[model samples]
Every structure is written in structure tokens, then in C-alpha cells.
Target: MTQQKVALVTGGNRGIGKEIVKKLIEKDNAVIFTYRSNAKEAEDLIAEFESTGIRIKALKLDVSKIEEFESFSESINLILNEWQVTGIDSLVNNAGIGFFVPFEEATAAQFDEMLNVHFKGPFFLTQKLLSSINDNASIVNISSTATRVALPGFSVYAAMKSAMETISLYQSKELGARKIRSNSILPGPVATDFSGGAVRDIEDINSRIAQQHALGRVGLPKDIASAVAFLCSEDSAWIDGQAIEVSGGYM
Candidate 1:
């Protein structure tokens, strides 16, 4: 009999994070995910999957607070106990906040928030959760293609994502003895509610962004989520320390 695999994703209540939860569940994996303050959205997602009879748990987590990671680890252990699993098989660092202010106008608060959410949060979360991840497990970091492209308003956010990519390479190397594979997925502009839904709600803005992509459209949550599912599966066992750009050929 094949045992069920467990996945942990941050900010799984909406956007690409929510879609990742859905795809992982569709793949027949149990999931424990986190959200910041969206209780209504989280509850709706949990209720949506209640009929499937698979394990699902969502908790409020602020990734910026590294001080809380120890307590968070305890909570994860409790979830694992309830799910009858000793360790999670996959971890997705997808929780984040968006900052679109131009670099010159970027405030200190915005810069620090971006740093903590995009870089420090994932770095420490994975470190604190290492003991709970099984051997040969997968870790996927959610990054942005802005790292390659010089987007004006995305300076801080893109820089932190770039740091995450670098951290992923080191994680893959250090965790190699345990066969843990770490990778990053860089998505082009997605038409989610992120950044106040500028891409999704404004037709002109969306068109401008879409024009940069060969696909002629901005991506959807499903577009990025599908890539996440692939990286978490054993099918990507040999793939590690790589940043895969799922941009539809966006320059």
C-alpha cells in the first residue's frame, strides 16, 4: 500500500498559494497550509475540500516573525500527529506581500516588509521545519521573474526573490545528504488579486503586461500552481538547485 504524502504551503488561502493547495490535493496529497489574516478565505478553502476525505489544515501564520517559528513548529507537529504522519514530504514557501512602489519612493517600512516576507521568512521557516521534513522531500520557493527583468516598482521584492534563489541553491547543497531537493519557481505577471489586482482588474495594465509574453496573456494561479505540483512530486527527484521560469517567454 502506498502511504499518503504530506505537503506544507504558506499563504494557501488565495492567489497562487491557494491554487497550489488545490493542485496538491488533486494529486492525492494531504496538505497543511498557512494564511496571514484571511480567516474567511481559509475556512472556505477548507470547507471546499471537506468532501474529499483527505487531511487539510490551515492556520494563521505571519512569516515575517521568525521569533514565532518554534511555536509554529510545535503546531506543525500536532498537525502531523493528527494526520498520522511523522514528517511532511513537501514544503512550499509561497506566503508573501507585494510592494509596487518605485525604488526612489520606496519607504523603509515597505523595504523591510519585503525583506522579511520574501527572504527572511522562507529562510528561517525552512530551517525551523527541517526536522519535520522527511528525507528526499521537496522544497519549492516562490520567486518572481522580476529578478531577471528590471522592473521599476519591483526593486525590493525582486531583490529578495533573487536572494531566495541563491538560498535555494545552498539549501539543495546542504540538504543533499538527506536527499532533499530545493528549487525556485519564477512566475511572470499573474492576474491574481496580488498587488491589488492591477493585472486582473485593469484591462489596459493587463494588456501592457501581456504584450511582453509570447503567450499574449498574463498568467493565472493555475499556471504557476501546476509547476509547483510537478516540483513537489517524485517525478522531479533528480531536479534540484534550479530556478525554473514559467513566464510564457516573457522578457
Candidate 2:
């Protein structure tokens, strides 16, 4: 009998992360996801999905805190042991925050937070989880199209995301001996809560964003989620260290 494949997605409580978790479950993999807070929502999702007989687990993880990575690894180790998993098949570093502060007004704290979540968190988390990753395992880092196209008021956030893209390449190289692959997905404007306030809820801004996309609409959570699913599967085994832009052809 084949062993079940296991995947861990950070920030999997909502938005793109949630969608990714759903798709992975659909593909018949046992999924363990992390959320910083929102215990009720996390528990509700697990309860709802568990009814379908899928293996879904949720844990609280603050990715911005580097000091917690070791503990996070311990938790994962415990889960692996309980599940009898020889190694984790995939890791999705999808937890992140978006800030719209203008460059001049961006404070050190804001920049630091962005850097910690987008770049530092993934870097160290992957490091801590390296030993537990299966050979030929895939790592997917969520990034932003803002890294490629210049966006006003997103200078710091974009820079940090860009750094992750670069790190993804290096990670792929370093993990090659272990047959581990790492790649990044850069999504364009998506209808998610990342836009503070009611912008995502507002029809005007939504329409504008949709019109800006060459596909005639902004991306949905499933749009990016599908790409992530593809990368995590064997269909993309030969693809590594690449930054795939799921931006609907945004310039």
C-alpha cells in the first residue's frame, strides 16, 4: 500500500491559502495548515472538512516570529509521528501580509514586519523543516506580481517579495542534492481581504482591477490555488527554481 502524501500550508485559514488547502485535499493528500489566530474559523473548517473523511489539521503559527520556528518544527514532527509519515511531501509558504504604505511614510517597523513575514519567515521555516521533507518534495513560495510591475505605496512589500523570489532559486540549488525542489508563484491583483477596508468588497475597485487584467478580470483565489496545486503535484516535478506569474497577463 502506498503511504499518504502530506502537505503543510501556512496561513491556510482564508483567502488564497484556504483555496490552496481545499485543492490539495481534493487531490487526496493529507493536509496540515497553520493560522496565526482565528481559532474558531480554523476549527470550523476542520470540522466541516473532516466530515468528508479527509485528513485535515490546523495549528496556530505566527510566521513573523523567527524564534517560534523550532517549536513549529517540533509540532510538525509530532504530527508526522502520529500520522506515521516518513516525510512531508510538500511545503507551501503562503502566509503573508500586504501593506499599502507609501515609501516616504513607511516606517522601520512596517518594513521590518513585511520583511519578516514575506522573506525571513519562509527562509527560516523551510530551514527548520528541511530534515523532515521527503526527497523530491516540492516547496512553493507565494509571491506577488507587484515584484515585477512597479506599484505605488507597495515599495517595501514588493521588495520583500522580490527577495523571496531570489531566495527560492538559491533554496532549489542548495536542496538539489536532497532532490528537493523550490519555486515561487507570483499572483496579480486578486479579490482577497489583503486590500484593507472595503476595497475588495467595493465593486468599483474590483471592476477597475478586473479591467486592468489582460484576461478581462482580476484573479480569484482558485486561480492562484490551481497553479499551486499543479506545482505541488508530480506534473511539475521537473520544474524548479522558477517564478511563475499567475497574473492574468498584467503588464
Candidate 3:
């Protein structure tokens, strides 16, 4: 029998991250996810999934602090040892934050927060965990369609995502020798808490997105999760160094 794969997904306590964890677990992977806070939600999810006999563990982690990555890597090493697994089969950088401040009002702190979470955190975390990533493994970075849509009031967020996409390409090239593939998924306006309910709960805003998208609706967490699962699985073995947009043809 084929061994069950192991995966680590950052910020998997809620939203799209939670859905991605569900999908990965459905694929029979031993999922180790991280959450910054909300220990209750994490604990509840772990308990709920463990009942099904699927291996799921949630660790506390703040992606913004690059200094914490080494410790996180060590914890992952311990998990792998306990599971008798050599290395993790997949890593998903899905933790992120968003704001809708106009460019003129966007503060340095806001920009830095987005940069730290979306770009710097992923870079350092991936570097620290390089050794624990298995040969022929997949790394999926969560980007945004805001980078492509030229959306106002999202310049800083989009720019950081764009940087991540570039980093994904370089990661793929460098890790190719080890047979590890890196790619980015650019999701459009999804009906999630990304904008603090401005889009998810606001009917008019959601309608605007639906009108713009060719699929005639804003994306759902499941949509992005499925795309992420595809990228992590062996089905995408030949795909690497590319940003697959899950925008539903949103221009």
C-alpha cells in the first residue's frame, strides 16, 4: 500500500485555509496545520477530524514572525519522527491578511504587515523547512487575483502577492534539483473573510464581483481549496514555477 503523504498548511484554522485542510485530509494526507490564535477552533477541528481516524494536528504559529520559523521547523521534525515519515510531501502557504485602505491613506505599518505575512514569512518559513520537505514534494503559495486586476485600494496587498509569485518561480528553479516543485495560486475575489466581510457579507460588493467575473459569481473557499489540492497531488507532477489563476475568468 502507498504510504500516506504528510502536509503542513499555514493558517489552516479558518476560511480558505480550513477548506484546504479538509480537502488535503480527504486525499488521505496526514495534515499538520498552523493557527496564530483561536486555539478553540483549532482544537475543535482536531477533535472532529481525529474522530474519523484521520491524522490531523493543529499547531500554534504566527506567520508574521520570521524568527519563529526555526522553532516551527523543529516542531514539524518532531511530528514527522513520531509519524515515522521521512519528510512532508506538501507545504501550503495560505495564511494572509487584507485591507481596503486607499493608496494615499495606506500606512507604512499596514504595508509592512501585508508584506511580512504574504512574502517575507513564506520565504523564511520555506527556507527553514527545506530539509523537511520530501523529494518530489509540492509547495503551493497562495496569491491573489488583486495582483492582476489592478484593483484600487489594494496596491500594497497586490504588490506583495506579485512578489510572492516571483519568489515561487525562483523557488521552483532552485528546488528542482531535489525534485521539489513550487507554484502559486492566484485566487480572485472569494466569498471569504479576506476583506473583513466587506465582500463576503456585503451583497452589493459581492454582486459587483459576480458581474465582473465570467463565471458570474465570486469564488468560494472550496473552489480555491480544490485548486490547491490539485497542485499538491501527483496529478500536477509536470507543473511547476507557474501561477495558476483560480479567478473564474475574472478580468
Candidate 4:
């Protein structure tokens, strides 16, 4: 019998992360996802899948708090053992905060927060979970289109994502011996509650973003989630160390 696949996703309670979890589950992957502090939302996500006869689990994790990673790794090991899985087949580094501080006004604290959540957090968390990640596993980092397009009020945020993109390449290079593939997905402006929901709720901002895409519409969470699911599957096995833009032909 083919072994069931397992995935560990961060920030899987809402927005793009939530949609990624659902997509993976739809692909028959057993997901063990994390949410920072929303116990209620986490519970709802678990229950929603449970009612559909899909068993999934959620844990509380603050990616900004690197100190908690060791314990979190232990918790993940316990879950893997309970599920009778040797290791997770995929690790989706999807947890992130929306920081839009401009270059002139960005503060030290904001910069550090962005670094902690985007760069430091995923870097170390992947290191911590390395032993539990199966050989040939895929690591998908959720990046932003800000890395490509120059946008005001997004200097720090985009910088952090650029760092993430760099690390993803290094991860693919170093982990190649174990056949672990690492890649980044740069999603264009999506109508989500991220960034205070300006893209989703504000018609002017939404319409402006829509014009940048060839599809003539701002991306939805499922648009990015579908790409994530593809990367995690064996269908993308030959693809590695690449940063894919899932922005509906955003130029």
C-alpha cells in the first residue's frame, strides 16, 4: 500500500494558510497545522475537516517566538508517532505577518519583528524539524510579489521576503543530498484580510491591484493554495530550488 503523506503547515487557521491546508487535505494529505493564538479558529478548522471525515490536527505556534520551537518540535514528533508516520512529507512555511512600514518611518522594532517572523522563524524552525522531515520532502515558502515589484510602505516586509527567497535556494542546495526540495511561492495581491484587509475590502485598492494581473482580477486564496499543493506533490518532483510566481500573470 502507498504510504499516506503528512504535511506540517504554519499559520493554517486563516487566509492563504487556511486554504492551503484545505487543498492539501483535499489531495489526501494528513495535515498537522499550526495557528499562533487563535484557539477558537484552530478548533473550528479542525472540526470543519473532521465533520467531512478528514482527520487533521492544529497546534498553537508563534513563529516570531523562536524560543518555543524546540518544544514545538517535540510536540510534532509526538503527533507523527501517534499517526504512525515516520516523518512529514512536506513542510509549508506559511506563517507570516503583514508589515508595511515605509523605509523612512520603519522602526527597529518593526524591522526585528519582520525578521523574526519571516526570516529567523522559518530558518530555525526548519532546522529544528529537520530530523522529522522525511527524505525527499518538499519545503514551500510563502513569499510576496513585493519582492519583485517596487511598492511604497513595503520596504521592510519585502526585504524579509527576499531573505526568505535566498534561504530557500540555499536550503535546496544543502538539502539536495537528502533529496529535499525547497521553493518559494510569490503570490500577487490577494483579496484577503491580510494587511488590514485593504486589498479585500477597499474597492479602489482592489481594482488597482486587479489591473496589474493578466487575469483582470486580484488573486484569491485558492489561487495560491493550488500552487502550493502542486509543489508538495510528486508531480513537481523534478522542479526544485525555484521561486514560482502564482500571481495570475502579474507583470
Cα-based TM-score, every candidate: 0.98, 0.97, 0.97, 0.98
lDDT, candidate 4, 1-251, per-residue tens = 78799999999999999999999999999999999988998998898867686759999999999899989999999999988889999999999989577799999999999999999999999999999999999999999999999999999999999999999999999999999999999999988889899999999999998998999999999999999999999999999999889999887
Model 2 whole-model lDDT (C-alpha atoms): 0.90
Instruction: Report the lDDT of model 2 for residue 146.
Output: 90
- The parts of candidate 3 lying over 4 Å away from their true place are none
Worst 10 residues of 2 by lDDT: 193-202
- lDDT accuracy of residue 85 in candidate 2: 85
Candidate 1 structure quality by residue, lDDT tens digits, 1-251: 67799999999999999999999999989999999998999999999978878789998899999998999999999989887787999999999988578978989998889999999999999999999999999999999999999978899899999999999999999999999999999999999999999999999999998998998889999999999999999899999999999989896
Q: Candidate 3 residues 1-251, lDDT tens each? A: 67789999999988999999999999889999999989998998898776688888889999999888888889999999988888999999999888888899999999889889999999899999999999999999999988888888989999999999999999999999999999999999888877787779999999997999998998999999999999999999999999999989997
Per-prediction tally of clashes: 0, 0, 0, 0
**Model 2: how far residue 225 lies from native, Å:** 0.6
Cα error of candidate 2 at position 207, Å: 0.7
Regions of model 4 farther than 4 Å from truth: none
lDDT at residue 207 of model 1 (Cα atoms): 93
| lDDT of every predicted structure (CA atoms) | 0.94, 0.90, 0.92, 0.94
Quality of model 3 by C-alpha lDDT:
0.92
Q: After superposition, how far is residue 74 of candidate 1 from its true place, in Å?
A: 0.5
Error of 4 at 245 (Å): 0.6
lDDT digits (tens) for residues 22-52 of candidate 2: 9999888899999998898788779878768
